[model samples]
Target: MKSSVRAVLGLAGGALAGLALMAASASAQTIAITDGRILTGSGIIENGTVIIRDGRIAAVGASVPVPAGAEVISAAGRVVAPGFVAVDSGLGGNEVSSQPEANDLRQSSNSISAAFDLSWGLDPWSITLPVARLGGVTRAIVVPSHPGSSGGHDHNHDFAGLGASGHHEPGLFAGQAAVIHLAEGTEIIVQPRVAMVAPFGNAGANVAGGARGALYTLLRETFAEVRLYARNRAAYDRGDVRALSLSRADLEALVPVVEGRMPLIVTVHKANDILMALRIAREENIRLILDGAEEGWMVADQIAAANVPVLLNALANLPGSFERRASSLENAARLHAAGVLIAIKGNEGSVHRAREARYNAGNAVAHGLPYEAGIAALTVNPARIFGQQQRFGAIAPGLEADVVIWSGDPLEPLSQPVAIYIRGVAQPLYSRGLELRDRYRPGQQPGLPPAYRN
Candidate 1:
């Protein structure tokens, strides 16, 4: 009886091991995309064929031979380009508001806190992901919105809230912003905080007592404090009298921005605000990227001279306020023509509205932005600005295969991405919006009753 029991136990263990091996072997299959109008970004391929293997582009040319036994995605008569990279987007997770528990993009009144990582706030399977993916946006820089004071003790007597650069409920004294891939598995998609955000507009003035002079003074003083902290690091560490008790978190966060290693993405739109931001960048020798440059055309020459880039919203043609009077569909084109590198961003509120990206590019093209240049604004330019140009932003050998096969000219409003490959794997094209459309359309099968469907 004992011998028989031992034999049975051994057989069970062997079966378990066999099952594990089979599961491991059943990995995602490889595919090859071929015969299409490939926009390599560096140039164009009229009859191009791209070979994808192991989730990367193996070869890309007019005559790349297709491999036997590999799945072939024929792209004849279609447009193929690198998946779009949105330089700034808010699609990864929810943007929480007044309710602290509901928000993950800003903190309250804590100072000296650069340890906040945006990945912690990321929801990998957000319903918005597929909407953006199917529309050709494969990656984005998820940024935190400006924090508002929640009746807490103000950090500076004049300022009501601390504004750090992160993607969660950061205290007004929060730290840097992290780059995130808009895909499953958050761990595999994190790039450490690459920049620290600083607000500089009417909002800044309001927080600084409605005086532009006071606002500038506060900014300068903050930098001075950071400089002092850097100089007396050792003394501060050793608790010496010479060491200041100023918590270095805010100052420390500015180190990368001040050193020009990371950019200061200032959120400003008016001409005065743009000038002030440009002056700050020059004075500090920090790289600057202007976000929401609604009136950027007014200062195009100055921006070009400074070699600064602008992130603009293509659809914000209407003038919502005096500061945005110069906003137009042609602003991006004018900036590009004046030698200012321009990247198009979506509305700050919805990052998954990528279906409008190509349309935005089309509008710019119609307004005199070169067609290819407009395409680059949505693809390669953003990737270059975010430091992923080599692997993303283009279709080429040795690059990650984040290719989008479109049904027609990508810039046309009617065009749609038939298939999207992220890291060489075709992602599911379904989105919550599409599911709702199918369920509610006049004649479609009723998966659920009216109330539940709606």
Candidate 2:
């Protein structure tokens, strides 16, 4: 049996402000979680005591002495682990999918939107954030997608009848992605422009003519221009430019991408295209993160050889399309076996499924992925890949207190977050769903409609 989630957030809009105050108050206090089965990401610490001070892990060990004036919470039979990191999501953006003005995830009006930073549109007060926090996800990488790219099931048809071939030119580059911290404050972005995104399979085919080859060619050409722009910046600024399809701003944004400073997160599903993407990564001398590599298991060795990490939808076993025909339940396990870093991402095209990352980890663990590896996929693996190793991930001393106490095995589907803490402060389990249920409680107001009762 699982315990109920801690409702740290109150049933009011001002709850966020209250949480901020709590964070401030907690910042000055030392918190100790003692006698818990701690999954330290590297290994387990049986009956460990994790001490947090000034919003960071002060010490972690089995016999760490509790300091005076420290607030101690005994986790006698609970499982404690670092909060899950949602690698690719639309967390800070896309609050309402149907409302275009509210959702700032993708800009379909332009194919070359490399300068379109996703952090500027981040909404910390989004309903999705608290829900995901309740699910034990404390950090996330909010990504932007190609406007016309066909992925994730849009059950509500939020993007129905939206073709990428409107006034916008269908090129390759989508935009920049942001790494976010789901703490209880307004500033959530950890690093902006962590990766520049591109599409390479059927979605790429849709955007860059009716062929996949064009997408690759256009991407290569863009990189080539980026190289030229890097070398001849002064000349290009004086109107003595070479052949360039992208603007100077975009070329400048992609400079880090080409120089291995920022990774290129390409959405390639087919094995053959994955191979091509690997080759591109090698030839261009850029770090790569393969997103949506549905057929990755087919060429696991090749991916491992390239030293490229793969971000996957761990539960994507059924054949959604021809590109994912080789998708298997053991894809994550096989890739891990082949020495590739596997990060569990959410479903393609869906922004609201960020919280399901832990469930995805559970599914992968059930399908033969090591339980530790599965947990690490949502923690250390992503943090290391995204260059946030020192600040986030793991439950080690000196790291941020992004930890969760689970009612049962965290990977088990039945288990849930009993308590969640981010940056040493406890997070709220409140959500729009809970608010609605409490607001429309039956018989609360028999003479009025449910909306008026509140």
Candidate 3:
């Protein structure tokens, strides 16, 4: 967790490390990873050995004994920590957004089905998956595009021209999000549906008659319809269900949201909108998580008071719209200082840069957030927010062995992982990008330069 400290990664002939890199798939033998600085999220332990057996962490501490017949992997001089989690990633569903054939999921729809699941489109062997693991990211939340992003649509800029545009398509909701492991092979999804995604702020206002009041009314009415539909299931079967704007499938998909089983993640900015979202959550007794709150620093106290978490792109410091005029590099620091829970998210697309979660944390640290807090934002905060903390976010005994051994301070882009594990099993170090790098080297017949040699 100490970004200033230089980690020593002795990896000339790490036999166990080599074994881990080459044969990181499932194995019958016990695994012991020793001699590394372990970041347990809750705290840190220096020179720790984490024992793993049967896909879970068995023991983790500085002096924990390595079990008999364990395949020992020495992580001497490396940073051992829980693998990073990139929330709201668009990985596995597509390799490139512009390419029609490479991508599987659809985008830019006016009213996408709320039941549209991303797990079915996941390409488990995506070329980007291994590279994400190479960057020390073991877990990710794959999400379809949010309908409210300001990238593709016209900004509803006539509202006093503060740069906020309340322009959005009518009834556009992103599909459900899924949690997946970055390990090789198949069965990528661990949780098929973690949250119900929707829009708020200017985007929602655009969709709901160009005003915040109307937007809130629409959301309330939608929830009421979902409730009525759930209560009168037999009536719906008999064609007696009340008329609703959303289809039955989409309404059914939202059942968990109202029942408090799944959270509703809304993309919103502006201080007033954030407060209004909180008020709606309170009134409905529903779980909520706010995303893209560029002006969140203005309402940090209110967020902490509500016990709601915020997900954001830590690198977002510029005012892209009127609603986000208060955006700054210190936003993350300000929120954390006020006791607000914060999680860092990454860019979402067919070619995902979600692995940049650590680098984004580094940026937050550079702007005043504590280094440990930055690490927590990438590791445990999202897991805690998304209800996956018991298994995916820590290096504790009985937790899933999704750990990483870093060559240096993980926040630094120059550094990389020497070994990676998901569910107690080491992952292969190879990636299609690295293979292309080797294949396209400048020199073949003779050595042109060290950088270009075969």
Steric overlap count per candidate: 14, 0, 2
**Regions of candidate 1 where Cα sits further than 4 Å from its true position:** 1-30, 67-69, 95-101, 112-116, 147-175, 186-188, 241-246, 439-454
TM-score of each: 0.82, 0.88, 0.88
lDDT-wise, the better of 2 and 3 is: 2
Model 2 TM-score is 0.88
Clashing pairs in 2: none
lDDT for 283 in candidate 2 is 85
For candidate 1, lDDT tens digit of each residue in 1-454?
1111011112224334323322322343445566789887667888888877787888999988777655566677778888887665656655333445645555544444444455577677676677777677887766655532111212333354434532112222234566665544545354757666655676556555566676678667656666777777787677663433234555567667656887777767788889988998899787988878888888999999999988777776887766677788889888999998888765544454745677788888988889888888888888777677777778888888788777788888777766667777665556788777767777655666766544
- Model 1 scores a C-alpha lDDT of 0.67
Q: Per-prediction RMSD in angstroms? A: 10.1, 5.5, 6.1
Which candidate leads the pack in lDDT?
A: 2
lDDT of 3: 0.76
Q: For candidate 2, write residues 167-186 as lDDT tens digits.
A: 22643667888989887687
